[model samples]
Target: MSMRLARPGTSDKAETSPLAVRGLTVSYGGDPVVFSVDMTVAPGQMTAIVGPNGAGKSTLLKACLGIVKPLAGRITAWGKPVARQSSRIAYVPQRTSIDWDFPVTVIDVVLMGMYRDLGLLRRVRPQHREAAMACLDRVGMRDFADRQIGQLSGGQQQRVFLARALAQQADLFLLDEPFAGVDAATESAIIAVLKALRDEGRTIVAVHHDLSTVEAYFDRVFLINRRRIAEGPVSTAFTTDTLHEAYGGRLSDGFTARRA
Candidate 1:
């Protein structure tokens, strides 16, 4: 199948952009990673960041959240700096980053999402626990709420983290490789929840690796290989050429021949 651009949904949605980045440049030890990239995320859509490994897709998300200091440029959510609107954004990190042996229960981890609203030194009320349990149910993990995190399988652990993100009820969700190392059941469950959230007008930006699923899973795409290659609707931007550029010599022919 040939690659083409999606209809121009991304062009006329400036008013709906909850997340906007301009002239963004990030570096580590004075070595540049992401170049000057300016992209606007339309509200209520799933935006996937796709590129070769080590191309800094995750770094771009971190820069948006002010977690990693950028040497240049700026990011804004809802026309305000992310630092000021942190409460409205939720992030689901890759499962590998989590410490399963930390002695936290499934529900306990989900409750962490509410601590921001609970405030410093404020006690977690019983209602907070109730809300967490509700989120666990949404992810099909309610039955595992009291279980030790380490005891769960890989997919179960992934679901637990997703439950935590859902409990946040944030307008914007930035997910890092939610599909990585997960079973098909877990992937199906997570995508179902994400689609439901999008139908509710919540914005989701995910760092995605599977090329074949891009068009099927996400509405928009951002292709990066240290520099932005394309940004727009999945059909329009996820072209063979863009993938080639982003992946460099790393893209497999099997994937290129397969259409999204």
Candidate 2:
């Protein structure tokens, strides 16, 4: 099933805000994993969430998308609570979670993105097909749309998932570890597509590793380690002091090149 793209609104009105979080907290089996946190994601920005492993970067993304319930505080998307605005939010989880044995085609998986708008019973229309193809083209995966997802390389699979997110036509995107385990070229392609989306007035938040690429890739950075140690433009937030705070007193692995 597929959904038709909503018509673009008038340019006069300001673009809608993307996401807001207040006093947010998360826990695993009653153990608090993230402390109270506040954040707002503006339209047309690419923000990277970074920290050491188990720093709650993925937890934050999951909390914002309503996949993991917050122990305290509220999350709002486009001024509505996450539960009420699921359709406007798109999520791309880690590729490791995908079942490689599944016999679905790349296009089929990408088409699933529209299922939320199409509901359950409807078939994908020509418009949906066209939109899906366009999204694939944007990610440079149009030629592989018919191939089985399992047959693709790690980078190709990543692009396929990105195409799926594009098909959703969402205003806010939350991508977890999209660059992990992919080749440098695939990483570059994903970053380019994300920048294009940001340029087109969409909001994107990603859980990213590779401290070397943080400044080169993201406009804003949120350093997290169960709490928000710092958040602001990359130039301000990627400092040694903030890195130490976010990485539990160790500044070696988290500092940007300028600080090293």
Candidate 3:
């Protein structure tokens, strides 16, 4: 894929750090979920956060996106605090989080990403529509632009959400389980888009659960279980030791342990 130009105001001299998290900790219902964690996402890199079920991987992503407030520590994007630069980040939640019964067409859902830039009183201009369509095309979902979101298959729905994130045109992209329940074809398509984004100097971080795909799909991997166990290039960080520490006997035991 051809590299896209960097967003305006991002200086050429600026170090290409897309996200920085320091001492991040989160709690749910007053119970600690994600412990103090430090992580950084560099431009043009695909970073995957992996762990066992209830390992706080999803919570970590949410904390970075500011959807779930962190009890302690800081998160910055493009050198600015996340709370101050929310527009610079786009997030695609787990597919199950969306209400499939909601009355909305594919186009409508994709257009939601543009609401921040368009504001409440303003209408979606032709430029906005064109951009949204282009995003859908990039994800190979242009043909489904008018279809009802609920009627589409799981993979199609994922593509639509990804297209919506593309339409947001943010500097950083956070995705939760983009591969879950997706068919091989859809998974390939999604990975291609992610690779394109990384090649274009965008930072893409995903909460990924499939250990088997880590080495194949990501440039960097973070193994976490409440706290970080290891983080670095997949080859260096995704070791048996780290897996054992992060997932305990579960990862080594088999699917049952991993799922437990």
Q: All candidates' lDDT scores?
A: 0.86, 0.83, 0.84
Q: Give the TM-score of candidate 1.
A: 0.92
Give per-residue CA lDDT, model 3, range 1-260, as digits (tens).
02211222233223346787778899987678988787767577899999989989999999887888889987777677788888888899999998987889998888999989888889888988889999999989999988888899999999999999998888789999999999999999999999989898888999997887887889999778888788778887777667777877776566435534
Could you arrange the candidates by TM-score from highest to lowest? 1, 3, 2
**lDDT tens digits, residues 1-260, model 1?**
14323323333343457788877999987668898877789799999999888888999998998889998986888877788888899999889987899998998899988878786888888989899999999989989988999999999999999889988889999999999999999999999999999999999999999888888899999988777888889887888888887787788888887753
The candidates, ranked best first by lDDT, are: 1, 3, 2
Residue 246, candidate 2: how far off, in angstroms? 0.7
Which candidate model has the greater lDDT, 2 or 3? 3
Q: How good is model 2 by TM-score?
A: 0.89
Error of 3 at 60 (Å): 0.7
- TM-score of each candidate structure, all chains considered together: 0.92, 0.89, 0.89
RMSD of each: 3.4, 8.2, 7.4
Candidate 1 lDDT score at position 42: 79
For candidate 3, the lDDT comes to: 0.84
Best-fitting candidate, measured by lDDT? 1
